[model samples]
Target: MSETMTIAPEQKAATGNSNKMLFAMVGIGLMCALLIVLTYEGTKPIIAKNKAAALEQAIFKVLPGTMTTAGYYWDGNAFSPLKGTEAEGQRVYAGFSESGTLTGFALPAVGLGYAGEIRVLYGYDPAQEALVGFYVLESKETPGLGDKIEKDPAFLANFEALSVAVGTDGNSLKNEITYAKSGEKQNAWEVDGITGATISSKAVTEALSTSTAEWVPRLYEAKERFKPQTQSHE
Candidate 1:
C-alpha cells in the first residue's frame, strides 16, 4: 500500500497566493509599458519642434551677420530648398545678411569625441573660402576638460577664419583641417587643442575638415543658387 502525497490546506493556500501575486506583477508591468509608449508618442512632435527651433538659432550663431536663413538639401547632383518641414536627408543652412547677401553657410558635422559623439555647426564663408565661426550643437565630452573645446577662448578662435580653400583639383581641400598643441598652431587651418581636451579638440577638427572637404567645393560652384529670390512684378 503506497501513501499518497497530498498538499496540506495551508500549502495550497500559499501556492494560490503566490500565483495571484505573480499575475499581478505581470499586469502591472504591462500597464507601465503601455504608459511609457503613450507618453513617448505624445511628446515626439514637441521634441522635434524644439530641436528644429534650436537648430535655427544655432545657424544664426555660427554664421554671424545672418539676418535670415534657408535650408537646402543636397540631392546627389545639386542642392534645392527644403520644402516646408522637410528635415530628412543631407542638408545645410544658408544664412543671409540684412542686404540679402549670402553671408555664409552653417554646416553641421559629427565626430567621435572623448566621451561620445560631438555634433557641431560651423560657418563656411564661400567668398573667403574659409571657416568663419563654430558652435557646439551637441556633445558628450567630459566636463571641465573636454568641455573646454567649446568654452576655451583660444580654442574657439581657431575657427574664426580657418582656411578650407579648394585645391587646384577644384574638388578637395588645399590643406586638411588639423589640430595642434595649445599655443603651437601654425597654420590658418589648424585648430588649437585644449591642454587636457585633446580628443574633443581633435574631434572638432576632424569633423570640420571632413565636412568642408565635401561641401566647400560644391557650395563654391553653386553659390549663385543660394542668393535671395527676387519677385517679378508683371
Candidate 2:
C-alpha cells in the first residue's frame, strides 16, 4: 500500500500544479483591473475637456463676435431651469450677439433613421421667426441614401424661416410643416424635398416637425417675455 501511496515527488508535483493555477488566476485578475484603471485615468480629462470645448465652439458658431458665457442661460430644454430646479436630459442653448441681443436658438434635435438615431444642432432666428442653419452632430443612417441629409447643401438650405400659421384653437399650428419641390416652395415653412431620396427627405421633415412644432411656440412666448421694453407712458 505504501508503494502505491503518493510519494514526496508526486506530492510536490500536485502542489506545483495547484500553485500554478492560483498564480495564473491572480495574474489575470490583476491585469484586468490594471487595464480598467489605466483606461479610466487616460480618458477622464479628455472627455470633460471635449465637452467644454464643444460648448464653446457651439457658442462661437451660433453667436459670433464675443467669446463669453456670462449672459447665456442654461436653458436646459428650451426653457430656463428656474431658480432651484435640477438640470436634466437635453439642453437648449441660446446665443446672443455682442450687444446682449438675442440672436437665435440652438437646439439639440434627434430623429430615428433607418439604421439608428440622427442628432443635430439647429439654430433658429427669433427675429425672422425661422430656422437659420443646422449642423449634423451624429447619425447612423445609410451611407449613400439617408446620409444625404447631412452632406447635401441643398437639403441643408431647405430650412429657413419657415412660417407656421397658428390655429385659433391653440393646441397645434394650423398648417403643418411641408416639403415641396424646388421653386414650388413659397412660404418660410415650406422645403424642397429631395428627389429620388424620399425616405431621407421625409426623415428630415419629420424631425423638424417633431422638434420645432413644440418648441417654436414656446420660443415665441420667451421672445415676448425677454424682449427689451420700450417706454409706455406717452
Top candidate by TM-score: 1
lDDT of 1 by residue, 1-234 (tens): 775688465643345588789899999999999999999999998987787677778888888898777888888899877764554327788888989999989888998998899998899998898899899988988888999988999899888899998899888888989878888999888888888888889888888878888888999888888875442101
Residue pairs with clashing backbones, model 1: none
For model 1, what is the error of residue 17's alpha carbon versus the real structure, in angstroms, after optimal superposition?
21
Residue pairs whose backbone atoms clash in candidate 2:
130-161, 162-188, 162-189, 163-188, 163-189
Structural similarity to truth (TM-score) of each candidate: 0.76, 0.67
Q: Which TM-score value belongs to model 1?
A: 0.76
- Which lDDT values do the candidates have, in the order given? 0.84, 0.63
> What's the lDDT for candidate 2?
0.63
What is the Å distance of residue 171 in model 2 from its true position?
5.8
Alpha-carbon deviation at 154 in model 2, angstroms: 2.4
**lDDT for position 48 in model 1:** 71
Q: Write the residue-wise lDDT of candidate 2 on 79-178 in tens digits.
A: 4432323332245555556566777666667767677777776776667767776677778777887788877878877764566545566546656777
